[model samples]
Target chain A: MIEVRLFATLRQGREKSIMLDSKDFSTPGDILKHLDIIPGEVSILLVNGFHKTLDEKLEDGDVVALFPPVGGG
Target chain B: MERRYERNIPALSDQECRLLRSKRVAVIGCGGIGGYLIELLARIGVGYIRTVDGDVFEESNFNRQLLSEQPLMGRPKAKAAEARVQRINPRIEVEPVSAYLDKNTAAEIVSGCDLVLDGLDNIAARRILAAACSEAGVPYIHGAISGWVAQVGISMPGDGLIDILYPQGVSFRDRSVLSFAPSLCASVQAALAVKMLIGRPVETGTIYYFDLLNQEFETIRLDLGKKE
Candidate 1:
C-alpha cells in the first residue's frame, strides 16, 4: 500500500488521506491517473518527502503528496 | 537613522541592525503585499529599498491593498509606496520605479539588490522575476496568496523551485486575494528576508503553507539531498 496526501485544493473536496494498492501503480503519475486528477492540476509532487516527477517510478510503501499552484497576490 | 533602530535592540542586535542597514532589497510590486513589506523593512531599518510597480491604484484595490487609500486611487503604486516610505522613515533610501518588470527590464530594475522580493499576483511575472534572480545569482523570496491561503518560499541559485511552484501556463486570476492574504504573506516574507540577511540560514528550497481559515501551517521541503 502507498500513502497519498493532498494539500490545499488538491484534496479534490475529498478526504486528505488516501491509500492505494501499490502493485497497480508504478509512479506518482499512475496514482494521479488512477484517481483521475486532471493534467496540470498538480503543481508540486512529493514522494516520500521530496519533489519527484510524475514519471518517476514508485515502489511499495512510497508516500506521495500533491500540491496545486496557490499563486496569487 | 541609527537612533530610530535604538528601540529594536535585543530583538535585532546592533551588529544585526548594522547588517540590515547596509543591505538593499528590491521589491517587485507595491500593491497589498509590497506595501506592507516596504513598511516593515523601513521600520526595521533596512537602509535601502528599490520598489517597482507599473499599476495605478484602482478603487477595487481598496478592499485589500494597504496603499490603496480612497484619496490615492489614481496614483502610481510605486510613487505612492515611495511617498509612504518617506513618511514612515525619512532616513531610508528608497528608489521607486514606476514601471513593469519584464525580461527586458528585469535586469535594470533588480540591479544592486542584495535580495529580491516577489509580490507579483500572477505566475508569469513571478517566473520572469525568478529567472532574473537566478541569473543574477541573488536569492529570490517568493510569496503568493489565494483567498485566506498563502505560500512562501526561498529560492537561491540552482534551486529551480520556481519552475516547480509554477508549472506551464498556470494563469492565476486577479481579484482572488483577500485583504489578509497579502498582509500575512508580506509579514512572512519580511521575516524570512531578515533572517537571510542576518546570517541565519533560511530553509531555502522549502515552501511554507499558511492557512488562515483553519490556522494551520505546514512545510513542504523540496530538497531531499538524495534520490528516493
Candidate 2:
C-alpha cells in the first residue's frame, strides 16, 4: 500500500490522504494520474519527506506528499 | 536603552534590550514585510536600520504592502519605510537606500550590518541576497507569503536552503498574497532577527511552513548538503 498526503489548498478540495494498493500505481506520477490530479497543478513532491521527481518509483508503503506552487510577496 | 523599554521585560532582559540599542540590521525590500520589520525593529530599539528598495509604491500594493497608502502611492518604498520608522520612534536611526538590491550591490548595501532580513517578493532576487550574506558570514532571515501560506527560514552559510527551495529561473506568476500573510511572516522574521542579535543561537536550513487558512504549522527540514 502507498499513502498519499495532500497539503494547503490542495487539501481543501480533496481528501486529506488516501491509501492505494501498490499494484495500482508504480510511481508518484501514476498515483496523481489515478487520482485525476493534473500534473501541472503540483509544484513539489516529497516521497517519504524528501524531494523526488514525479516519475520516481514508489514502493509499497511509501509515503508521498504533494504541494502546489505557493510563491507570493 | 531607556525607560521606553521597561515594558519589554520578561520577554527581554534589560541587558538584551540595551544590547538591541547598539546593533544594526539591514532590511532588503521595503514592501509589506520590510515595512513591518523595520517598524518592529525600531520599536524594539534596534539602533540602526538600513532599508533597501528602489521601487515606488503603486495603487495595487495598497492591499498588502503596509507602507503603501493613498497619499504615499508613487513615492519610493524606502522613503516611506523611513518615514514609518520616524513616526514610530524618533530615537531610532533609519538609513533608507532607494535602490534595487542585486548581486553587484548586495554586499555594499548590507556591509557593517549584523543581520540581513529578506522581505523580497521573488526567488531570484533572494538567491542573490543569500549569496551575499554567505560570503560575508552574516545570517540571513527569509520570509515568503502566498495566499494563506507562508514560510520562514534562516540561512547560515552552508544551508543553501534558498537554492534548494527555489530552483533558478522559477518564480511566482500571478500569485496573490492575502494582506495578513506577509504581516504575520514579517513579525516572525523580526522576532528571529532580534533573537540572533541578543546572542541566542538559531538553527538554520529548516523552514516553518504556516497555513493560516487552517491554523496549522509544519516544519520542513532542508538539507541540500553543505554549500561549496
Candidate 3:
C-alpha cells in the first residue's frame, strides 16, 4: 500500500491521508498523477522522513507527505 | 574616526566590538524578519553576512518588509536586501544569494558562519536549517511570528532543541499575516545575536514567546526528551 499525507494548506483542501495498493502504482509521480494533484503546487515532498525530488521512485508501504510553502516569519 | 555602536560599544569593550566585527552570520529567508535582522546586524558592523532567499519582492510585501517597496517589487529579495544593507552601512560585507536553502547548499552556506538566524517562512526550511546547523556544529537563533504572537529561541549543537520545541511540526501560514510578528521576534533575535557574538551570557536552548495584543512576554524551558 502507498500512504500519502498532506500538511498545512494542502491538508485544508484535501484529505490528510490516502491509501492505495502497491501493485497499482510504480512511483510517487504516478501516485500524484492518479490523485490529480497538479504538479508544482506543493513545494516539498518527504518520503519516510527524507526529502525526495519529483523523479524519486516509491516503495511498497511508503509514507509520502506533501507540504505547500507557507510563510512563517 | 567613523561612528561606532554607542550603546553596544560602551557595554562591551573595544576588543569585544572587534570580535563581533570579525564574525560571520548567515540569515536565511530575507523576508520581514530577515530584512530587519540584516539591517540591524549591518548597522552594528558585523564583518560578514551571507543572506539567502529564493523569493522576490511582491505587492503583499510592502506592508511590513523594510526592503520592500513599489519600486523593488518583482526583484530578488536577497539581492534587494543586500543592496539595502550596503547602503545602510557600506563598511560591512554582504553576500546575497538568490536560492532556496536545501540540503545540498545548507552545509556550504552555514559551515563558516559563527551563527545562523531563522528568517524563513516555512517549517520545512526551518527544519532543514536546524539539521544543517546541527551537522555544522554552529549555533542558531530561531524565530517565528504568527499574527500577534512571536517566539524566539537559541539552539546549540547536540541540543535537539528544534525537535523538542516543534515536535509535531510548525504551522505554515501566509506571510502577510505574520508581518508584525517577525519584526517583534527579529528585534529580540538581533539583540540575542549581538549578545552571542560579543560573548555575553544569554539563555540558551529555551523558548521565549511574546504576545503583542496583550503586551506580555513569557519564557518556557523545554524538555526535548519527550517527542510526540
Candidate 4:
C-alpha cells in the first residue's frame, strides 16, 4: 500500500492520511486521480523528501503529501 | 561626500558599509514584513532593492503596517513602500514592481539577488519562491507570522528542510488568526536579512517561533535526514 498525506490548509478539508492498495496503480498521479483532487488546487507535491511533478510515478510504501497555497502574513 | 548613511556608517565600518551599498536584494511582499524590511534595508544603505506586491493598503493595515496611513489609503503597497524608502535614503536605489511573484517571473527577479527574504503572506508564493531559489542556487530566509506566533528559517539548496518542516500543503490555519504576529515576525526577518548581508553565517534550516502573548521563544530543528 501507498500512503497519501495532506498538510496545512488541505488537512482542513479531508483526512490527514489515506492508504491506497499497491495493486491499484503504479504512480502518484494514479492516486491523485483516484482521489479526484483538482489539478491546480494542489500546488506542491513531495514524494520521499523531494519535490515531484504530477507525472512522477509512485512505489509501494511511498509517502506522498499534498498542500495548497496558504498565506498568513 | 553627501554624508548619506551617516547613522549606519558608525555601526558598520566604511568598508562594511560599502558592501551593503554594493549588494542587491529582492523583497517579495510589501505588506507588514516587507514594509518594515524595505525601510530597514534602505536606511542601512543596501545598494539596491526590488520590491514586489500586487496588494494595496487597506484600512485594516493601519494598525501594524508602518508605511500605511490615512493619506495613503488604497495606494498600491509597492509604490508606498518605494516612496517611504526613498524618503529614508535617497542614495539607495529602490525598484518597486506592483505585481504578484509567480513561477514565470520569480526566477527573473530572484536570480540577481544576493539574498532572498520571504515577505510573502501565502504558502503558494512561498513554495514557488523557495523552488526558484533552490534552482538558482541562492540562499533564502523565510518568516511567517500568525496570531501572536511567528516562525523563521533559512533554507539552502538540496537541504529540503522546509519540505520537512512544512511538508508540502500543510497549512497552519491558526497563523492568520491575529494581526500583530506578522509585525513581530517581520522584525525578526529584518534582523536576519541584515545578518545575512554582512557576511555572517546564519544558523540556517531551523524554525524559530516567538509567542508574544506568553513571551516565549522556541527553536525546532527539522530533521534534514528525513525522507518522504
Candidate 5:
C-alpha cells in the first residue's frame, strides 16, 4: 500500500493520511486525481522523502507527502 | 557585556555576545515578520542590520505588523524598522534601504552580509532573494506564515530550499494570516539566527513546520546532499 500524507492547508476538510493500494496509482498525479486535488493546487510533492515530479513512478510502501503553498511574511 | 543583554547570559556566552555584535544581517521585507525580527535582532545586539522594503505601512498592516502604527502609516516600512531598532538598542547600526529587492538589486542587498533573513510575502520576491543569497555564498533563514501554520528553515548557499518548497510558476492561494502568526514565526526565525551566529549547532536544509492551533511541530529534513 502507498501511504499519502498531507500537510498545512491540504489537510483541511480531508484526512491527514490516506492509504491506497500500490497497484491502483501509477504516479503522484494519479494519486492527486484520485484524492480530488487539482495538480496546480499542490506546491510540494515528495515521494519517499525526496522531491519528485508529478509523473514520477510510485512503488509499494512509498511514503508520499503533500504540502500546499503557504507564502506569507 | 552590557546590562541590556544580561538576561541572555548562560543561554549565550560572553564570547557569543561579542560575535553577535560583529556580525551583519540583512532582512528583506519590513512588514509582519520583518518588523518583529528587526526588533529582536536589535535587542540581541546584532551590530549591523540592513532593512530592505519598498512598501509602506497601511491601515491593514496594523493587525499583525509590530512597526505599523497610526502615526507611522504612509511611512516606508524599512524606515520604520530602522527607527524601531534604534529605539530598542541605540548602539546597533541600522540601514534602511526603503526599496524592494529586485533582480538587479538582490545581489547588492545581500552582499557583505553574514546572513540574510526572509520576511517576504510573495513567492516571486523570495525566489529572487534566495537566488541572490545562493550566488553570494550567504546563508539565508526563511520564514513564512498562513493563518495558524508557519514554516522556518535555513538555506545554506546552494540548497535551493526555496525552489524546492515553492515550485516555479505556480499560483499560490491567497491566505490571510492571524495577528499572532507572524510574531510566533519571527521569534522562531530570530532564535535560529542567533544560534547560527553564536556558533551553535543548528540543523540546516530542514524545514521546521508548526501548527500552532493543534500544538503540533514537525521537522522535515530536505535531501540537500549536505545532511549528515
Candidate 6:
C-alpha cells in the first residue's frame, strides 16, 4: 500500500491522505492522475519524505506527499 | 538590558540581545511578510536592516500587508518598512531599496549582509534571492504564505533548499491570503532569525508547514541526497 498526503490548497475537497495499492500505481504521476489532479497543479512532489519527480518509481509502503504552489509573502 | 527589549529577555540572554544589535539582515519584499519581519526585527533591536522592494502598497494589499495603511496606498513598501522600523526603534538603522531584485542586482543586494530573509511572493524571485545568498555564503530564512497556510524554512549556504521545494518553471496563480497568515509566518521567521543571529545551532534543510485552519504544524526534513 502507498500512502498519499496532501498539503495546503491541495487538500481542498480531497482526503488529506489515502491508501492505495502500490501494485495499482507505478509512479507519483499515476497517483496524481488517479486523484484527478493536474500535474501542473502540483508544485512539490515528495516520495518517502524527499523531493521526487513525477516519474519516480513508487514502492510499497512509500509515503507520497503533494503540495500546491503556495508562494506568497 | 534596555527597557525597550526588557521583555525580550530572559527569553534571550544578555549576550544574545547584544549580539542581535550587531547583526545586519536583508529583508526582500516589504509587503506582507516583509512588513512584519521588519517590525519584529526592529523591536528586537536588530541594529541594521536593508529592505528591498520595488512595489508600492495598494488597496489590495490592505487585507494582508501590515504596512499598507489607507493613507499610504501609493507609497513604496520598502520605504514604508523603513519608516515603520524607525518608528518602532529609533536606534535601528534601515536602508530602503525601492527596487525589485533581479539576477543582475540580486548578488549586490545580498552581499555584505549577515543573513537574508525571504518575504517574496513569487517562486522566480525567491530562487534568485536564495541563489544569491548561497553564493554569498549567507544563511537564508524563507517564509511564504497562502490563505491560512504558511511554510518557513532555513537554508544554509549550498543547501539548494529553495530548488528542492520549488522546482524551476513551476508557476501558479496567486492564491488569496488572509490577514493572519503572513503575520503568523513572519513571527515564526523572526524567531528563527533571532535564533540564527545569536549563533544558536539552527537547523537547515527543513521546512515547517503551518495549517492554521486545522491547527496543524509539521516539520519535514529535506534530504537533498534523496532527490530523484
DockQ of each: 0.59, 0.42, 0.14, 0.15, 0.56, 0.69
Worst 10 residues of 5 chain B by lDDT: B219-228
Off by over 4 Å in 5: B225-228
> Candidate 2 vs candidate 6: which has greater lDDT?
6
Report the TM-score of chain B alone for all candidates.
0.94, 0.94, 0.92, 0.90, 0.96, 0.96
Off by over 4 Å in 6: none
Candidate 2 positional error at B154, Å: 0.6
In model 3, residue pairs whose N, Cα or C atoms come closer than 3 Å (at least 3 residues apart or on different chains), thus clashing, are: A72-B121
Candidate 6 chain A least-lDDT 10 residues: A38-47
Q: Is candidate 4 or candidate 5 better by lDDT?
A: 5
lDDT of 6 by residue, B97-212 (tens): 99999999999899889999999998889989988998999999999998888999998888878887777656666578999999999999999999999988788778888988
Shift of residue A28 alpha carbon in model 2, Å: 3.9
Q: What are the chain A TM-scores for all the models, listed individually?
A: 0.91, 0.90, 0.82, 0.82, 0.94, 0.94
The window of 10 residues in a row where model 2 chain B has the poorest summed lDDT is: B165-174
Instruction: Compose the digit string of candidate 4's lDDT tens values, residues B1-228.
Output: 237756676667777778888898888898877877787778777889988898988988776677888998889999988888888877678888888889888888787888888888877788888889888888887877666656777888767755654544455546443556666776777677777888866887576666565576656455554543
Q: Ranking by TM-score, best first?
A: 6, 5, 1, 2, 3, 4
Consecutive 10-residue window with the lowest summed lDDT within model 4 chain B: B168-177
TM-score of 3: 0.73
Across residues B1-228, which tens digit of lDDT does each residue of candidate 5 receive? Answer: 798989989888999999999999999998989988998899888999999899998998988998999999899999989888888888899989988899989988999999999999988989999899999999999999888888899999888788778876565675688888898889999999999888889998788888777777877777775322
lDDT of each residue in B100-190, candidate 3, tens digit only: 9998889987878999999987777778899999899999999877666677889987677666544353444444455677778888999
Ten-residue region with minimum lDDT total, candidate 3 chain B: B167-176
Please tell me how candidate 2 rates in CAPRI terms.
acceptable
Instruction: For residue B133, give model 2's deviation from the true position in Å.
Output: 1.4
- Chain A of candidate 5 gets a TM-score of 0.94
lDDT score of residue B173 within candidate 6:
62
lDDT of each residue in B58-175, candidate 1, tens digit only? 9888878888898897989999999988998887899999999999999888888999998887788888898889788899899988867888999886577888787685544333
Q: Cα lDDT for residue B188, model 3?
A: 94
In model 4, where do residues sit more than 4 Å from their true spots? Answer: A1-71, B1-6, B9-11, B175-180, B225-228
Each candidate: RMSD: 2.1, 2.7, 10.2, 7.4, 2.1, 1.5
